[model samples]
Target: MVAVALAGGLFTAASGCAAEPPSPRERLIQDLKTEPQFKDYSDKQVECLADAYIKYAKPEAIELIMQGKTPADSGWKDGVDGRTLTRDLAACNGPIAPSPTG
Candidate 1:
């Protein structure tokens, strides 16, 4: 019975270790998934968008997000030249389909 109790205690201790929290980039991807602008995008597309933000957006933009700020609140657009970010994000967005309203 003592051996069984010891085994149970070991199991409890092993399971008590918590998993590491998500990284900043992972948090950014999760945040992007909830954005209305990305509503039509697939998970892969959202990940791509996050990658673009990491690569093209200013370092401060990502840092702000890591500090619990939303991308818009972080002034993501103003962080870097819009044109460059636009060009990089365009690749992630792929070919745009014509709007059904049109």
Candidate 2:
């Protein structure tokens, strides 16, 4: 039984280590530098930012995101959408890879 428990713990640790952590907006910006296609912009990005805004920010804040503005500099008055935006951002974690530059 102890061996089985140890194996399980090891497996859990391995899985956790193998999984890559999600990127932050700042990281995304850096990625955009190399993969400029990501910089091209998209309606989906706006929609995601809007969803994120609605969760962590106000309607106007969400509007800013929908307009392609980053939520970090939108002058939010009510504070963060917190866990809500965090969850939405997770859900919005689809591919944002830029297309070929040339």
Candidate 3:
């Protein structure tokens, strides 16, 4: 099981070329599929965490979290309770195909 992080933001340079990155929900799932710690988690767990993160966290904070930081450590706690997501993730079993939304 792992912690959840969520988000979305806009950024602009002096030239006014602004860009919006993928949703926090998107990033978390990407991490779960790619990042070392999360890659091995079941799709159910990733999906569960993604939903929780979108409901509770800031997207930008996910980078630090992927680096092994917790929602509390990165101070991204908001929306749903972190404990609930953690418990849900722990219950999910995976590494299977036919992913949640892949």
Candidate 4:
């Protein structure tokens, strides 16, 4: 689950980095910057994507969303990886949110 992967990544980063690790929101922004689907995105697209992502987030991830963090949640399975997130987002219709790419 996301909790497990987050825990793992958090620990690894904490152990390896002398500086602060990127916060969830920062990570989200960084990831968004690299997303191919988001490349042509203007400001509207950024907001739209963020808004759309919020609508699709897992129930547990809603809080992080409210806090403007990444859509990572404890309820999500780590089996859902980054590639899956993009595919899922692209495939999504209505309000179905993509899972975290752990």
For all candidates in order, the CA lDDT equals 0.78, 0.55, 0.63, 0.57
Clashing pairs in 2: 38-98, 56-81
Cα RMSDs of all predictions?
5.8, 13.3, 15.1, 18.0
Name model 4 segments beyond 4 Å from true. 1-26, 59-102
- Give the per-residue lDDT digits (tens) of candidate 1, residues 1-102: 999999999999999999999886798898888778889997878888888877766667777765766665645645577788788788778744556877
Clashes (candidate 1): 0
Candidate 4 lDDT, 39-96, residue by residue in tens: 7665445554554454445645745544557764453444556675666555433233
Q: Candidate 1 local accuracy as lDDT?
A: 0.78
Task: Give each model a TM-score.
Answer: 0.63, 0.29, 0.44, 0.31
lDDT, candidate 3, equals 0.63
Against the true structure, candidate 4 reaches a TM-score of: 0.31
Worst 10 residues of 3 by lDDT: 1-10
Candidate 1: misplaced stretches above 4 Å?
63-85, 95-102
User: Which one wins on TM-score?
Assistant: 1
lDDT of 2 by residue, 1-102 (tens): 999999999999988886556444433344433444445546466456544544465556444544667666655546555676566676655545554762
